[model samples]
Target: MAYQVIIIEDDPMVAAIDRQYVETDSRFQVAHVLKSGGEALGVLENCRPDLIILDFYTPSMDGMEFVDRLHAMGQYPAIIMVTSANDREIVHGLLSRGVLDYLVKPFAFARFRQAMDKFLQTQNLLSCSQESSLLDQQAIDRLIRRQERPEPGGNQMSKGLNAATLERVRSFLSASRGQALTSEEIAEQVHLSRITIRRYVNYMVETGELASSIDYHTGGRPSIRYSYTGQTAEP
Candidate 1:
């Protein structure tokens, strides 16, 4: 079943965009697109959504106040803030309140996908923990050290490579384990260009995150295919 999502944005265009981005991933479906935080809060009273795409500046209640109200009501859903607000105080407040991810306006689709991927990963981990009733040290560590964007000079990522895009590719390939995929196949699913996906796959191959093989059965030039190696890449 796909996870249910609710979007709270005042602008119709932005709300539509958020819905489009959220639904792009097969794991999530937008359950509602509310224009005000107050309306959203009322809706949350009965149903608990898996995630929420929220804007900081909305009628009825601002994002911060909305978060506070949700906490007061003992309702905690994964939240990804998609707003134009770049104030450090607002960001810090939202982060302190445990907002899963924040994206300033004019962000790329890659960044949006990265946030969704993060929420899905966290949900998966939580589900595992619930089933096991216990978490190992590594599992605990992974839960605590949620993936974040690398610093500008961070050597963890190669130059000219985006951490978010790399994660998207890695997550998709991981899901398709046991099946080798060409760059074009991956690009089509991830909504990225074939050339861009090829670059990322090459980097993953070099870093040992993916195994590459040649497929000569295409009746023409042999094409390269990549499969996840079941190895976790350094964050």
Candidate 2:
């Protein structure tokens, strides 16, 4: 089925670009595009979308505040914050709150595609599951806690991570909560090199953090799915 999406952006140009990107493929569609969060609210009541691309800043209501209101009302939508802001804290904060993914502003169409693709893949993984997630304190903590790794030489990295490349990869596996992904897919979401991603996936499999299954009928190596045993990825 085609994924329905909404764009909540203040800039007409940016919103237009986003709409075009969402409708570029038949697998995705833009249900509605609005300039402010309040406009989004009424329109959304009548039309629901699978995902919402939110701008952090708008004239009427900002993205974060809108998200807070949505949560208060027990409404949840897989959201991707599409903002020009470079505030690392805000970026990580929203991500830690169970956002499907985060994208900095002024991004290329290719990057935008990667973000949506990864999110849909994650959604697919979520849909295939039959079990329910508990919302206990521990579960909430795991969902929001910092999971980035530190770079070598003890210096801070471009993105927040606390360990070496492989260690960070291991952390993602243990934290995935049982999601399967390809190396390229993981790399896109994590902001890492594809080669580095493959190395980490391989390491995880060797260490038993991930198990590989073959696509014998399809060809090539079997796709590996990792079951995160530590905490629930859901918040």
Candidate 3:
């Protein structure tokens, strides 16, 4: 079954890009593209969407207010917030109010695809037969986790490092162009540990999406600096 998706974003370009992204997946359909919370609220009253891709800032009303109104109307659908806002307090509040996932602005297609796939996985789990075992319940819990999952080909799942997150780190660096970033710096931006980021950076360098150079110091240990190669990072 194709999942219905509603996108509420004000910027025409961003909305268009989002719609294009949704079109790439056959399992999802773009049901509506409203520019404001008020417009979405009206249409969503009768439209039963399985998911909503929301923007934080909008005319007429904002995403937060729209969510509040949806709750008031008792319309509960999974929400994936796409916005430039990175305020921790706002994110905490939104998660508390039932947001399924959060994606910062300027994210690449890989990250977006990962989010959609994970949501689909959750939906599939929810539709499982009622005679579910404890193992099935555990699997469902893992699927419902907000974190990205490793690609099937990778054997490093034990590290909690996923291909999507690795691509995210690569995409972030690609956006930086020629700037050299340390593992610590990348970790800070990507919200991963220094070790995890370092592993991904090395893997990217091996795969040729990025190149690494040694930064020598007088007495300290030489540091590795990573730069984007202006190529696709897909393995």
Top-TM-score candidate index: 1
Could you tell which candidate, 1 or 3, scores higher by TM-score? 1
Q: After superposition, how far is residue 54 of candidate 2 from its true place, in Å?
A: 0.7
Candidate 1: which stretches are off by over 4 Å?
Answer: 148-235
Q: What lDDT tens digits, residue by residue, belong to model 2 across residues 1-235?
A: 8888899998876786677556545567788888998888878677768899998887777677788777775678889888887688777777666776678876654466557666655564455445765355644453344222222334323223334765666666666656766666678777898656654554344334565432223253334334444422111
How big is the positional error of residue 113 in model 1, measured in Å on the Cα after superposition?
A: 0.4
In terms of lDDT, the poorest run of 10 residues in model 3 is 214-223
Clashing pairs in 2: 148-161, 148-162, 149-161, 149-162, 149-163, 150-161, 150-162, 150-163, 178-227, 178-228
Models ranked on TM-score = 1, 3, 2
| Candidate No. with top lDDT | 1
Candidate 1 — worst ten consecutive residues by lDDT sum?
Answer: 147-156
| Selected candidate, larger TM-score, 1 vs 2 | 1
lDDT ranking, best first: 1, 3, 2
Model 1 Cα lDDT, one tens digit per residue, 1-235: 9999999998876776677556545567889999999999999999899898999999988999999999899989999999999999999999999999999998755567668768877787777756677878876787778754444434856447898999899899999999999888999999998767866876676556887665657775456678899765554
TM-score of each: 0.64, 0.54, 0.63
**Weakest ten-residue segment in model 2 by summed lDDT:** 147-156
Q: Report the Cα lDDT for candidate 3.
A: 0.77
Against the reference, the lDDT scores of all candidates come to 0.81, 0.64, 0.77
